[model samples]
Target: MGHDLDVLAARFGRHYPRWLLALLIISTMTMVLSSTSINVALPAIMQDFAIGRPLAQWLVTGVLAAMTSGLLLSSWAQARFGPRATLLTSFGLFLVTSLVAPFVTSIWALIAIRIVQGLCAGIAQPLSMVLIFRTYPGEGRGMALGLFGLGAMMAPALGPTLAGFLVDHFGWRAVFWLPAPVCILSLVGGALLLPTLRSLTPPRLDVPGFILLNLALFGILAALAEAQRFGWLHDATLLTGAVGLLGLAAFLWRCTHHSAPLLPLRLWRNASFRHTSWVSMVLGVSLFGVTYLVPLYVQTVEGYSASDAGLLLLPTGLVLGVAVFAGGWLSDKLAARWLLVGGLGLLTLSTAGQALMGTGASFWAICAWASLGRLGIGGIMPGVSTAAVQDLPAEELAPATGTISFMRQLGGALGINLLTFFIEWRHVAEGASAAGDAQAFVQSFWLLTALFALALWPAWLLRSKR
Candidate 1:
């Protein structure tokens, strides 16, 4: 494979970057598609597994938590294993898990497999970003990452529709099967074209810090997931919350004091990166939060089928793909702070529109609202992502990319559970009528709108340093 790739590279030396981008995008897309495509399949999985929402919720949140932890591992993995080995290994693991998932006999087994899948995804994603950032010139990096973002976002945007169709016709298992072929292709591509960008002296993995971070993330998500069922003051919730907080504090302390920390704590000193990280976390709340909420609302409250719910967001996906490219192009031409603020404003408007929408709101109305939100996301991703690492030195690329991705996924995992808790709490408070369910969803959207509005402060702070 190495010899063949070398020959091919010599023949197409000038076009190497494009080929590399194409390979990375598709690989990353397969990983991201796996993440959100399962959202529509949640109902089916619940029914098949004879599980409640909170337990079934683990299938998603567990993966996000694992994925979030996996992001921090990218820099370490790249240093220890090199990029070629790391990317291929992650892709290979993802492929095996996707293949095995359909056959799991127990819900715990499936969730475990999915978490493994998420770990692989978490490792692969940020490395791809680092590679893209390295491959592109300064002038075109925004557009490059924008195109990369489009591929990543496109999967989540369109994945559910495909997943819904698969679930309706085949079964929930088909969603697991969906990424297998693409993952295989990615594996082959990585083996052939991936450069071995290893550190000169490999960094030792911080096993204790890694364990602490996962403990913190899973503890918090577990607490959030169960808080509505067990009161927030309940022992389980309180215990888990405390575990998460303490673990987080310990991990931060380790990052500050350890000789070779898992994360580069000093990266936070970059004011632009700090602002961008905040904006990214807040954006994840809206991005993944809405994706999880919308499908459940349409299917349960509005009496749509899974496929119907997925179809409603189909237009939004298409619009978002185009908007992301435009946003990337615009980032190169405009101040990133302006794009970030404008994007947040649009997201706030989109969620507010959804909040005010009644259960009887028309399909097109919902589509319009969803598309507006995605447009805002498209605008935000290119600007925020470009700003996060643009000013950092080359050596910080892996950790910087991993940190930004970590913040986003951390927000997403927690955000999804928090949104779920709100729905459950509101449903119980208002009684379980159809009206109550609809109102619960409406209230959740309002919560999202508020979060988006709150993000504008960080977005404003993303000004270019003189």
Candidate 2:
């Protein structure tokens, strides 16, 4: 009866394909916008805080720690609460968070709000994928995922540039305000257009699992992020990291054996799931690094201002949007394996090209590499997403989607941090000095290239869609 209600809602109301696509894009944009805006404003944040400088900025580190924690809860929330409620709640919190973020008076306060934003982000993203599976049927389903990717993936690509402009001309506060309406609009629009699909056999919230999982993540990531700055075995960070790892191991043990694990282990049984998870993990480390490094390349190395770097990256978002659409259409027609392999291959090449870049590399060369990488990323993301969750039964779709998406997010976070740490280590080893210098950035780019290459082996295991 409820399924019939959902059908009627989807059919008689605002119909799910194009309208829901718009909603999905808008919804994801709000989160993407928030994330990008924060990155652009980190400098202003330091100035406002009048705090000490660390090699890795606390603004980003704090957000990552928070987002990682949030990922632990997202799947459980979607399974227990229903995707529609989860999505609505996430966007609603996001809007509120974005509106008030600019007014934060202290660095810790800012970090706190961002941590909350990450939690909200966790709910919004995984739920977006789950909805497409539920609302979009047949080929339209593939199209829906593509459109969702366009908004989610492409937004961050363009956001840094836009945020740079807002921060330079306006204050950092403007960054928070710009996305306020977008979030609000997404909330209102989603409420109206998206069908009310409630959870089936809603599971009770697993509070103990949530606590254990988060403790593990917090300890592990904090240790990893801080260890590069602090020593591994000498510092408290090492202790924190060890605790987190132990917690993670325990969490896994529970997941594999528990009747109602936070994330059911059976989902990993799909070949696509296993492949995409590993590949996405590796790509996460590389792609996240590249996104951060790319802007730094143009601004610090090329001597362009933040605004210029952002504008240079603008074309990337356009290309990426186009790629997502094209990739999604092709995902349905072609087996994802070759597409996956080809996309990752191109991405690896682009990373290598970026790594080889010297201080004097031409502007056009940089732009060309960015475009190529975007194209490859466009092709592979849909394939990763579509293939990863393909074999799951209807009931498990949300968790499957959430778990894969979570891993990707997790990968990207770890990748960016790992790259940053590796580059910093290289710089210190070579006695390189300061931010905004091309010499300091060169080795880091190469390291990331190696990381991208490392990501390719997972795609080898992917079988052609038969």
Candidate 3:
């Protein structure tokens, strides 16, 4: 019921060190930039291995899958190891992986290393939100996430630009090299800047439930990732998918009965948290799907450089920054319900416009529609973030934020991989190649628009506490 950060800050006094916050932001930016820096490197990766779209796509899916599985362990790790120790350990893992990734000869080896990198990277993702939850108050949570966003959002647009340049001039290895220093810096920052609040009362670990839920989530996502590569109609694919689904159902059912379940059924028991989380998931799906698809269209279809594709995305990123800040600031004062609705609606419209693009449509039109749809995402990002943090019990804030972030990551992983598959399938079904089929690109947007519509229900159903 009480404001968490205001209370903590008041206790720390006005002189609470600012560099700690700086470290958090810097570390977050570096970690994110490293992760995304690969988008532009995909072409190089494919060429190096002489692989196809599905295998190259797995480089991303594998990392996301690792992160998804890793999130389930964050709370437990933090509780046992403490925040700084956990963060530093994760950074160490990331540093090692990044340094080694570029030297591998085989695509399978690169992916194998990436899977390790994903587990390492996963540690940072949840803790960033958890830190803000622990350190900031209800009204202040928006400020924290906004500040966090400011530090990280640029990487999505910049990573490819930097990677493209690095690959064009130096090598793909340079792209991996870029983040290595950042990871070291994060380790240094984690040592000094991260807060040192020892867990006062650790939650009991539900080990059995944790294993069941984690395996189920891992199975389903892995199946989704592999489905596109292996024919979906194949007997093994159908059998594994059915088992994965059943496992997922069982995991959800078991969570309800466990005393301290991994997800905590109670978090979703809240009217707003439940709705907003679904919105977050749908938004994640739509956002990642588009992020992957658009860049590919520009670079592969239209034959632009990765740097240029990133530049094309600049307007959208800038507007997204504006929308996120505005939404967060307004969350405390305005009715967030309509804001959520309008955001999703605008997103749908923009995606719809993208779907109508012909083979020879104006290049600028791609930029316009992409920017428009993403602004909607920007508007909702902070609001959806605010929704859960605002109503939560002070103690549960960390877990809640971590869980929401995990959902977004999972959605991104699932959306991008699956949509890539869908785009290929639809093209093949039409007796076409994805490279030249403008209609295939349009069909890809159909899935994204449908996802935006799915987001609408959650945004509409979620009631603002204000």
Candidate 4:
């Protein structure tokens, strides 16, 4: 069987790597679109479920949390089950989950399904990077990584526009149905196109490490989710935060001590990986923070409809997609440190501009600011990803990619929750007028600007050579 699979891979290898990359890109776009496109539909869902902003926010939080947990297992799954089987399984689950999503009646049920959907997505995300790096030559890998970044970045870019249209015309349930066709196509293509290569000796799954990591993630998110209502100093909130911190500490210790750990802590010994990981976390915060806030602000404060708000983001998304491809191409020739500095610098400016928006801010103004921020993000993504793994040996690639992906998602999960809390707090403090809501959002953007600024120093410290 192994020999047969090797022959199959050789046969496919003759066709060039582009075909395989196409399939992987489509699969990635489908899953990522599922994650971000839903934000445009949140207002509609809030109305239907009769829930507040905080509860509605869980739809995203649940998915991010699940995705974060799922990423930790991706490298292991690929090592144990082979990349081909793992991707096929994830795509199948994604298809099934999308089919079931439209029928969910309760908010909790929807969150549960979103979690499962996220898990499926998590399984596929890291493999997208691993497979691409494995297939493409080192000379061209930067361009390949950029193309992959385009798809990954474009999903969130285009997701809101698509979801907005669906939500406006067919309602929120339609948003859930969007990924169906893409999933079907990916599953079929993956079955035939994915390389079948398994680990020689399957690694042991770190059950205890997995448990501690999840505990930390869940506890931190839960604490933040409830902090708006419970008060920060409340016993429950403090207890949950403490538990999460303790779990994180224990997990770190285990990774250092265990012979076969869930995450290899030694990966951090490389300065490039360490700096890139920090930038990745801040990028995650900035990326998701803007994505979440923009639609909500436009809808609630500016009185734009779901479709209108979604449309507002279309131009920014389009610009970001193009910029990502260009950035990836540039990564091959330029030093990553300069790219990171420029990108983060622009991101900070764009975010600061967003903080200056008032209730009377025009649609074009919003579009301009968002496009600028996304352009910065596109530039940062490919460079950061390429830099993170450039120094690692072949064997460390899987874990390094998985670990980096995990950090970004972890930052996303926490960032969104933190932004939500800030929004809620500011809304209460400023009072509940349209202008006041806009002010609260402005305050949140300022906070994001600070984060973006903080990320720049580390990004500047990245290796100066390609």
Mark the regions of model 3 whose C-alpha exceeds 4 Å error after superposition.
1-16, 129-145, 269-271, 361-363, 386-400, 434-436
Winner by TM-score between candidate 4 and candidate 3: 4
Model 2 agreement with the true structure over 366-438: per-residue lDDT tens digits = 8788788888887787778767876667897757766766677677666666656666666676666654345
Model 2: colliding residue pairs = 161-310, 284-412, 285-415
State which candidate has the highest TM-score.
4
Residue 26 CA error for candidate 4 (Å)? 1.2
Residue 335 C-alpha lDDT in model 2:
78
TM-score of decoy 1: 0.91
Off by over 4 Å in 4: 2-6, 9-18, 133-144, 233-236, 269-272, 386-398
TM-scores of the candidates are 0.91, 0.86, 0.87, 0.92
For the record, the alpha-carbon RMSD of candidate 1 to the native fold, in angstroms, is 2.7
Model 2 spans with C-alpha error above 4 angstroms: 1-21, 47-58, 61-72, 75-85, 132-140, 190-196, 266-272, 332-334, 386-399, 434-437
Model 3, range 36-127, lDDT digits (tens) per residue? 66776777778888886777877777777677767788777777777777888888887887898878888888888777777766777667
Task: Give the distance in Å from residue 419's predicted Cα in candidate 2 to where it truly belongs.
Answer: 1.6
Give the Å shift of residue 88 in candidate 1: 2.2
Q: What is the Cα-based lDDT of residue 297 in candidate 1? A: 87
Task: Tell me the lDDT of model 1 at 338.
Answer: 83
List pairs with backbone clashes in candidate 3.
5-136, 5-137
Q: Which residue pairs in candidate 1 collide?
A: none
lDDT (tens digit, per residue) of candidate 1 on 1-466: 4434355467569687788899998999888888888888898888898886677778878878888888888877877877788899988889899999999889999989989988998888888877876667576776677678778888777888888899889998999999899888988877668877667798788899999888888888878876866778999999999998899899999999998787678999988888889888887776677888898889878888888988887898898888888887788788888888889999999989988987789999999998999889878987777788877899987578667877888888888888888888888788987788888898989998888999899878776632
- lDDT leaderboard ranking: 4, 1, 3, 2
Scored by lDDT, model 1 comes in at: 0.84
Cα lDDT for residue 303, model 2?
68
Expressed as tens digits, the lDDT of each residue in 48-90 for candidate 4 is 8898787788888788889988888887898899898899999
